[model samples]
Target: MMTLSAPLLALLWLVQVVCSAFPEEPGPLSSIPTEVRKYPVFLGRPHRSSLRQEPLHIQRILQVNRTLYIGADDLFRVELDNVVGDEMFYSKKRTWESNKNDISICRMKGKHEGDTLEMVGETVSGMARCPYDPKHANVALFAGNLFTATVTDFLAIDAVIYRSLGDSPALRTIKHDSKWFRYQLNKMVVDTNAGPHGNRTVLFLGSSRGTILKFLVVPNQDNTAPNNNVFLEELEGYNPECGQDTPQARQLLSLTLDSNSHTLLLAFPSCVVRIPVARCQLYSRCMNCISSRDPYCGWTRGSTCSFLRAGTLPFEQDVDHGNTSYLGDCDLLQESYIEEPDGLVSVNLLVLSAVSAFSTGAALSGLMVCWIMTVKHRQRSRGGGSGPGGRRKCEKEQNMLG
Candidate 1:
C-alpha cells in the first residue's frame, strides 16, 4: 500500500482537477506504416559573427538536397555532407544579414573627370516587415516559385533562384480583404506532389478561425490560361470556444504536413492536434467514396473507402472528375436499403412514386396558370378598358335582367 502526505494528496487532487478541465483531445487516424529510428544525432550550432548583437530566433527552415536554409532576422545556408564511412559533417554559411540601418548609395562611386562629382543617396532603416515577424507569416519555396503570405497579403515570385532581387518582378499579389474573405490568413503549407497526375501545387492555408482553406495554383499551364484561385473546400481544423462574430481571433501558431504519415500538424494557442489530410472512412459506399473527389482517398478492397496506400492495386479513384458512373453499378446506391421487408419496400416505393408524380403535376399546373395569366394580361392591355372594376365589368348592360 502507498501512503501520501496531506500536502502531497492535496497537490494530486489539484492536478486531477486541472487535468479534467483540459482533457487531451482524441488522437488522429493513421493507417500508413512508418519506420522508426531511435538513434539521435545533434548538430553544432553555427557560430555567430561579432556584428550580430541580438539573439537569433529561427523563423523558418527549408531543406533542399544536402543544403538546409535557415531564416531568422538573417538567412543562413548549411551544407550537410557525409562521405562513405566518415562521421557526418556540416558547414554553415551566413548568406544574408540584416542591418539596423540600410544605407543605399546611388552613383556614390563614380569616375570624376576634371573635378566635378555628383551623387544621389537614400537611406532607410527599421521599417516593419511582415516577413520579419516571428510567427505571423509563412514563406514557401516550391518549384522555382517563392510564395509568401502574411495576415493581409499574398505574393508569388517566379523563378526566384535565377533572378536577382533587383530584377525579379512579382508574379502575383493579392491583398486580403477580411470583410469578404472572413478570416485572417497567417499560416500556409504548400504540397507540390498533389492531384491525380502528381504535378499540381496545392496550398493549405490556415486562418485565425482555426479553419483551413485548400486550393490549387496552376502556374503557366501549357495549353490554356490558369483559372482563378478558388478554394476546393474549407475544413474545420479546430473550433474555438467563441462566437463567429467575436472580435477576438484565435491564430494558428504552426501548420506543417508529414508526408510519410499523410497528416497535417496544426498548433493552436491552447492545444496541438494532428489531422489526417484525407478522411476516407466518412464515405461508406463506392459511389459515395468516388464522389468525395479526394486524391488521397480511394475505394479499395472489402468494399471500404480507404486512404490510397502506395503500390495498392485495383482501387477506384478519380479525383479530377468525380464520375459516379465509373463503377458501372451505382444503381446500387438507389437500392441500398435492402433490409426492409418486401411489402414495406413496395409501399415506400409507391409512396415515393406518388409524391414524385404529384410534384411534377403541381409544377405543370403552375406553368399552365402562369401562361393563362400572361395571356389575360396581354388581352387586357390591348383592350384598354378601366373603371371601378377593371376590364369594363364584362359589359353590365349585356345582362338581360339588368
Candidate 2:
C-alpha cells in the first residue's frame, strides 16, 4: 500500500466526516399548477359600505372572464378593469331572516365609460326561518340562474332556483320534484362546474355540523320545468369531522371552491381544510380522501390537518395583515388564466449550494488547524528524544570540548 502524508490523511478523514453528517439534498417546496394566461382583473373590497360594520361576509365569488361578481349579505358588488369605482346593488330585503328576502344577481354590460350592472331579477322564496343566531343570507349563480339558501329554525331553506329572461322583470322557478331538495339545514351554498356530464353543479354546506352535500341539476324533457331547470339529485354527502356540538363544529363558517382544480376549501375558526372534488366524485366520500394530489387538502407547514386550533389566525388575516390588502373583492377578478413561473426548483438548488459551501469551508478550516498542531508536536518529540543517534552526537561534542 502507498503511504500518505499526515495532512493528506487528515483531509480524507474530514471529507468522510462531512459526508456522514449530511447525506440528502434539501427538497424544493411544492406549488400548485399555474394557469396559462392572465389579465389585470379587479374585485371590489367587501364591507365597503359603511352601513355594515362587519366586513361583507363573502358568500359567493364568480368570475366571468375578466368581470368579477361578489355576493355578500344581500348585496352584489361589481367591478371592471380600467374602472375607477365599484358599483353596488342591494336586494329589496337586506337581512337573511325576512320572509320576502330576495336573492340578488348582477351582470356586466357595455364598455368602461358607460358600463353598468343590471339587477335583472330577484327571488322571495319562503322556506324556513334563519337557523343561525345572527344568520346571514347566502346567494349564488349557476348555469345562468340564481340560487339562494338561508338557515331557518335550524333547517336549510333553499329558494327555488330562478332564471332571468333578458331585461324583463319576470322571474321563473326551476321546477324539479326530486327528494334531494328535502329539508336538511344548509348554512352556505357555492356554485361549481362539476355537474354530471359537465353541467353546472351546486355544493351545499351544513351549518351546525360540517356536513358537505352536493346536488346536481340535469336537463330533462319535462317542459313542465323550465329549460334552465332540471332534476335535482343528491350526488354525495360527508361529514368532515365527528364531534359536532363542540367549539370546532360551532365555528363552521363558510365554504368556497377553486374552479380550476375542482378543490373544495373549507374555512373554520382557526384553520382552513381542503377536500378534493375528484376524490369526492370517485369515492363518494370525504373522510380519508385528502391526498397529495388534492388541493388545500394538506396541512399548512408545521400544522396539523385537523380542526384549526385556537390562537391561530384565519387565512383571511393575511388579507389585511400590516394594513396590506391581500385580496380585495375587485382583486378576485379573473381574466385569462395566467401561468405562474416555475422557480421553486431553482430556488431550492440555490439554497442548497449556499449551505454546502458554508459547511465545506468550516470543515476545511478545522482540519487545517489540527494538521499544523500535529506537525509541531511531532517535531518537539523528536528534539527531546534520547535515541542512539542523539546520544553519540552529544558525546562527540563533549570530547571535543575536553
Task: State the C-alpha lDDT per candidate.
Answer: 0.53, 0.40
Give all candidate RMSDs, comma-separated: 29.9, 25.3
Report the lDDT of model 1 for residue 174: 45
Error of 2 at 52 (Å): 3.8
Report the lDDT tens digits of candidate 2 across residue range 1-402: 989999999999999999999755322122212210111111222334534323344455554543334555543434323233222222223345534323222223235654656566676444432224444564445444433344333333333433443354435455444354333444656564443223344444544444454433344568686544222222222232212235333344556565554545444432233444432222111222122122222222222222222333332111011122332332223111122265544333566799999999999999999999999999988987678878988999999999
Regions of candidate 2 where Cα sits further than 4 Å from its true position: 1-49, 53-77, 80-183, 186-202, 205-366, 381-402
Candidate 1, 1-402: lDDT as tens digits: 988899999999999999899845332122212110111111223432323223333454555655545455456555534312211122655546445454333345455785776566765331222333443444454445444443332222111212112336644444334465456777889877764346556688888766777664546545566454435556776533221323222345578775655656554433333566666665767787777666667777656677776666678886656687646875353323323455564444677899999999999999999999999999888666655564346766466456
Per-model TM-score on C-alpha atoms: 0.39, 0.25
Candidate 1 lDDT score at position 13:
99
Candidate 1 residue pairs that clash: none
